[model samples]
Target chain A: MKLLLIITGACLILSFIGDRRKTALGLKKGAMMFLKILPTILTVIIVVSILLYLVPEQKIAGWFGEESGFDGYMAAALVGSISLIQGFIAFPMAGVLVQSGVSYPVIAIFITTLLMVGIMTMPVEARYFGWRMALIRNSLAFVFALVVGVFMGFLWNLF
Target chain B: MRFIKKHGVNIGIIVAFSLFAGYSVYTDYLPGLEILKGNFRTFITELISMLPLMFILIGLFDVWLPKEKVQKHIGAGSGIKGSLLVALLAFMQAGPLYAAFPVAYTLWKKGCSRFNIFIYLGAFSTLKIPMLMFEIGFLGVKFSLLRIVLTMPAVIAIAFIMDRYYAKKSFEIKSLQ
Candidate 1:
């Protein structure tokens, strides 16, 4: 966050020096973009955070815990696809799971899906690229996330 | 009526959430209101921190980035160098994936190839530098590195696949743009 602030600040200064009018135009565009995106961002936050807060970590771990079978991995992927689990929460949770002996593939599936497959954002994305493309991207992303996870896990075992 | 029409989706969601939350709390099955408070705080904090700066950056780039330059760097047939550049762009970004969409759209307008656009989105999903650093701290360097190595190929492969699909269809991005 600090880094982003510094970079944006520097760019704002450079932009001001380069052309005040364009900088003002940029600010206006920025404001417009923010307003346009507000609803979708809020929608995602409401759905994802609510779903996240609904379930206890222990309950989640129980269902998708280290001791869980393949079902746990599948369940985690589905949840990750639908939800936005912030890195702050997800990475630490994953670290804990790792220490607890959850296999690499399980964590891999979870993290990859969380990053690559966002069902919540599909409506907005589809607005730009069309539903067919959005659907293809997401479903393909889902398969690739799992593929990457399993591949990473296999490589980890090899070494 | 005007206000409701403008805010329909958002209002609808809030109403649904309110009903669900109220029932969950009333039934004593969930701490819906409590969770909503906690989650809302997080939502606000994250939104405030990310949106303003990110949108400004996108706006600035949109204004400043030359079309010829964008095309020369990442347009069709730019190949490996283009992929690397797109990846670097994605790495610099830090926030939710939703935040990257507008930037990607801008790039598309600037004539970035469909393949490179896909690469940018794919890389943004997983290669964020700050996030990677944090992940490494928690998951170990080896684990983090392996995941990146494994994930990059998959991302590229999918980008290639999607690019082909888009190109073959002569996907009319203009319809929406």
Candidate 2:
């Protein structure tokens, strides 16, 4: 954590030193942009946090816990596929979910597929990569996500 | 009408994405489904917050970094540097790829190679700095770092495998006489 902070601090310092005026201008611009987007982000976080507070983690974990078997894995994948979350949001979300007792495997599936196979982002991918490529890529990604989940589950069980 | 014609596909795509997202938000069936509404709220907020910073960064990149320099670094001969470059770019970039279309298109038209473009697209899924920061803070650096490292090989492997097989296949099928 300290290392990460130091790296960020160094980068900031370097950028500041490299071009103070430009960096200041960029920071100002970024601040304005962030302010514009802040409300929506906060609202979503509040809603999700509310849901987190309301839902029973035990119930969720019981259903999709490591002991839940194949059913659990499938449920995880389905949830991930349906969510269509961007990668940025997915990891932290998965982390919180895992901390709440959701299986590591399940969280792994959620994170991998969150970016790999995007049902919501399909058309865009298709436009760029071709439908065949997109479909194949997403399918492969889905398969890999499952693989990742299973692997993580095994690791957790082993370690 | 002209505007519609120009943006027809994009508008359709945005609406379709919204509907699908809305459906999930409304369903609230899964364990986390109820969080959908909140996720939506935060998602838009983050997007708004990051968009300008990103644009400015893009502008800085545009101004300071020479296209040829970027191209060479990410292009065919770059090897691991290229992959790292892709990962860094992906880590730095925000927004879905759809939103990145104009930028990608512009770069492509500006003589960026197909290989680099593919790397960038692949990187799109992997590198997300702000998200990583949040995850590290919330989940612990080890978890985030492990996942990031684990994913690095996976993404790069996929890119390379696709590069070797799919790239050629697409070219053959499309450009054949």
Candidate 3:
């Protein structure tokens, strides 16, 4: 964080030397953009963190672990789809899920889909990629997620 | 009247679905209602904390970068080079798609190909820097690299398939009308 501040400060100094208007413009624009998204991103992170804090790993594992069946996979996928958490958060969640006896496949699928597919961000996706493309990509990704999940589960069993 | 007539069925479906969802949630059948209720305050507070930085970054992108430049570099007719460049840019880019949307919308309007847009999004979502770092840190660099390499082709393939097979269609099934 200190490094980031130093870099940003250097950039600002350079920009100031080069052309004040352009530098000012960039700074102003960056500020506005950051302001708009900060709330939502923070909301997502905090909510996900609190969720991580609250949800017992053992219970999550029980839903998706080795003794579980397709129902576990479904539960995992459903959880992945609904939560808009980042990989930073989700991967730790995956580790917890694994410790709880959740199958590797289920955790893998949950993590993959949680990162790749955005149930919450669908509207943003639709705006950029068009609705059809977003839907198809997400659905296909979901399917591949399942395949990956199963493969990983089987591999984990081998070891 | 004409607009409503055109979208009336879709509207009806959404309303009906929302009503059902609300009713179920209210009745406690949603199962995870506690999470929402439990996390509400903390979530909002965190969101507030992060707001200033997010907006600053967004505003900088908007003010510093010219839409024309982005479009020219990433636009159609640039082919594989453009696609690769878009991928790289998207990969290096930080933050969520929400911040990226203004630039992307400008590019699309200025005639960036559907394929490039798809590739940009595919790469952006999958190949984020923070994620790569985390994977490498925890999973061993080789395993992480392999996964990244494996996933790149998949992302590109998904984009290619969509471009070839599904680009022309609307999201909704026409039959619903």
Candidate 4:
């Protein structure tokens, strides 16, 4: 967060030096963009919150734990796809799962899909990139996330 | 009226959720309300933390970086260099996936190649420096490294496929524009 502030501060300073009018225009454009997307953002947040409320985290961990097998991978992917936790929170939660005997492959799939696919952000993505691009990118990411999970598992077992 | 027409669905969804929350509270379903409030707070904080900076940077990019300059680096014939540059920029970023959209839109308008733009978004979604560090700390070096190694190729391949598919159908590009 501090990093963002620093960067914004620097940009504002630089903008003043370079062109004050442009700087003002930049701020206006930024605010406008924010307003334009506010609705979609709010909707996504509500949906995510509802999902979080409904899904039991403990049940999820159990389904993805050791001996869960292929079902575990699917479960992890599904849960990861739906949830919108930040990476900071996600990695630690995943770490706990790892220590608690959730297989690496499942964890890998969970993390990969969580970061890459973003079911929750599809509306925002579609708004910008069009539904075709957004859908294609996400579908491909989902398939590749599975491949990465399998490969990570293979590599882990080998060594 | 036009704004209402355009945002009617979103506004409706918001209203529905608000009513649901109100009902939940009236029924004394405190847990659901608590969860909703907590999630809302986190969502707002995330937005407050990142959106301003992202938009400001995008605004600055729009103001300062001319189309010609953007095109020279990442447009039609930019090839490998363009991909590399975008990937680097994306890797350096620290924010949620939603924050990347406006920047991507700006890049697209600035004439960045669709392929490199995919690479940029791909890298932004995963492989960010802070995210990687967190992964390494929790998941260990081997797991983190393996995911990174595999992800890069996947990102590139997806970019290639999407670029080709979009090229074949200019309608997609036109729609986005």
Candidate 5:
């Protein structure tokens, strides 16, 4: 947040000094864009909150552990792909799972899919980037997450 | 009426939330209300903190940065340097994945190569520095480092595949612009 503030402050200062007209225009454009996307933003936030509420974390963790094997990775990836938990909450929770003996690869897949594929944010993504790009990108991310998970498992074993 | 029509989805969601809240109240289910309130509060706080700066940055890019310059650097045939620059920029960003969408749209409209845009989005999702730090803190150095190393190549490959696939289709960039 401080970084954002610092950057924004710097940009504002620079814009004011460099070109006052552009500064005004930028602010206006920014506000306009904000308004334009406000509905989508609201929908996404509400949907994510509801999803997090419904899907109990313990249940999600229960679906993936060291002994769960290939099925466990797939389940983790599926859950991660759909859920929209924030990184702050997710990382700490994942950390606890790791300590509790969940396979690192499963955790990795969970994190990868959680970040890369956003089923909940699909509407927002499609709104911006089109349905084709949104769908293709997400599908590819899902595949990559699986591949990466397997590789991470091998790497973990090697070391 | 036009505004309502345009925001129909959002309104629908709001109505759903209200009905849920009403039902919770009727049933004396206090926990549901508590969850709703807490979730809403968190969402609003996140929005307040992130959206303004993101929109402002997008505006600044739109108003200040010349399309030609952006195109020259990251457009088709921009090579490895363009990819690296975008990857670095994505890594520096500190926000949720959705926050990257507007900026990516602006870049796409400005004629950034499809490959680089995908790379940018991929990097934004998983390679954020702050996120990496958090991962390291929780998952340890080896785990975080391995994921980072592995993800870079995976992201690039996905970008290439996406660019190739989309190029064949009449994927018009003009509609959004």
Candidate 6:
């Protein structure tokens, strides 16, 4: 993030050197866009924070890990889609679960849905892609996440 | 009244959460609040460091990069080359999926095809370089490699489905402003 900010600042200076008015115009436009998106972004952030607080990540693995069947993949998929936690956190938690004997396919479903499908962020997505499009995209992701999981089961032959 | 209406949901969320947080503190309940604080710290860090820069970069993209350039590369006819480029762009990015939204929107506005946009989103979510490295560190290369192999085709399939689904539907990206 610091790197990104520094690069942006450097770019701004370069743009200023090239054309002051255009640089000003770009800044104004960006600020406006930022303000416009702020509310929805904040709302999503709060909702997600509260959710993580309430559910906790530990409980999520147990939802499907013990099942080791069709139902297990479904449960993991559902948990993952709903949680939508960051990869930084999710991957480590998943790694711990894997070490603890959670099936590879279950972890696959969990990780895929967690990353690809976001039930919580659908409103934000709908804001850009429209409700129907968001629904279709997420549905497709959900199905494919499951498919990915099933394929993992076959590839690993662990479950 | 108009302003409140405009931001009603966000205001409601903040006010309600604040009250709840205060009550939690007064009542000696702080686990949730503590978690919230941690999450907020992370969120604010990203907000401060990445988002504003992202917005301005998007602005620069808007001001400088022409629609024809985006279209010629990632639009309907760009095909496999476009998909590879989009994947590379997604791999280079280091932010969360939501941060990619505006960038994707900018690309869309600049004439990127629906297919490439979906590819960009999927690839951004899963194929990012730093995140991939982190995943490998945690999950091991074999597991991570299998995941990438499994996910790539799925992403492309979904992208194909999304493109075909939206191929006929006339739609507009809702303006938040």
Top candidate (DockQ)? 4
Q: Deviation in angstroms for A53 in model 2?
A: 3.8
| Chain B vs. true chain B: TM-score per candidate | 0.55, 0.48, 0.49, 0.54, 0.54, 0.55
Lowest lDDT block of 10, candidate 4 chain B: B68-77
Interface RMSD of each: 8.0, 7.5, 10.2, 8.6, 8.5, 9.0
Which scores higher on DockQ, 2 or 4? 4
Expressed between 0 and 1, the share of native interface contacts present in candidate 4 is: 0.67
Model 6 misplaced stretches (Cα beyond 4 Å):
A1-67, B1-77
Q: Would you estimate the TM-scores of all the predictions?
A: 0.60, 0.66, 0.54, 0.60, 0.60, 0.59
Estimate the overall C-alpha local distance difference test score of candidate 5.
Answer: 0.77
Model 6 chain B, TM? 0.55
User: What is candidate 2's lDDT per residue for B62-91, written digit by digit as tens?
Assistant: 334433454444444345565566556555
Looking at model 2 chain B, which ten-residue stretch has the lowest summed lDDT?
B168-177
The TM-score measured for candidate 6 stands at: 0.59
lDDT by residue (B1-177, candidate 6, tens digit) is 765789898889988877877887788777756855676556555545555666687566556644345434654435678778777777766555777778778777766667888899998877766466447655767788888899999998888888887789885655456
lDDT of 1 by residue, B1-177 (tens): 755688789878977877877786788655666666676556557556755776687677657753345434554435678778777777866677877777777677777778888898899897776466457655777788888898898898899999888775866343344
Q: What is the alpha-carbon lDDT of model 2 when measured against the actual structure? A: 0.59
What does DockQ come to for candidate 1? 0.36
**Which segments of model 2 are wrong by more than 4 Å?**
A1-18, A156-159, B1-88, B99-118, B164-168, B172-177
Give the per-residue lDDT digits (tens) of candidate 1, residues A41-104: 5666676566666665566566765557668778768988998767745675566556545667
Top candidate when judged by lDDT against the true structure: 5
Best by TM-score: 2
| Deviating ranges (above 4 Å) for candidate 5 | A1-63, B1-77, B172-177
Which tens-of-lDDT digit does each residue in B95-139 have in candidate 4? Answer: 778787776776676677878788888888768763564576557
Residues A26-50 of candidate 4: C-alpha lDDT, one tens digit per residue: 8888778667766766676676667
> How many Å off is the CA of B77 in candidate 1?
8.2
Tell me the deviation in Å of residue A94 in model 5. 0.9
| lDDT of the structure predicted as candidate 6 | 0.74
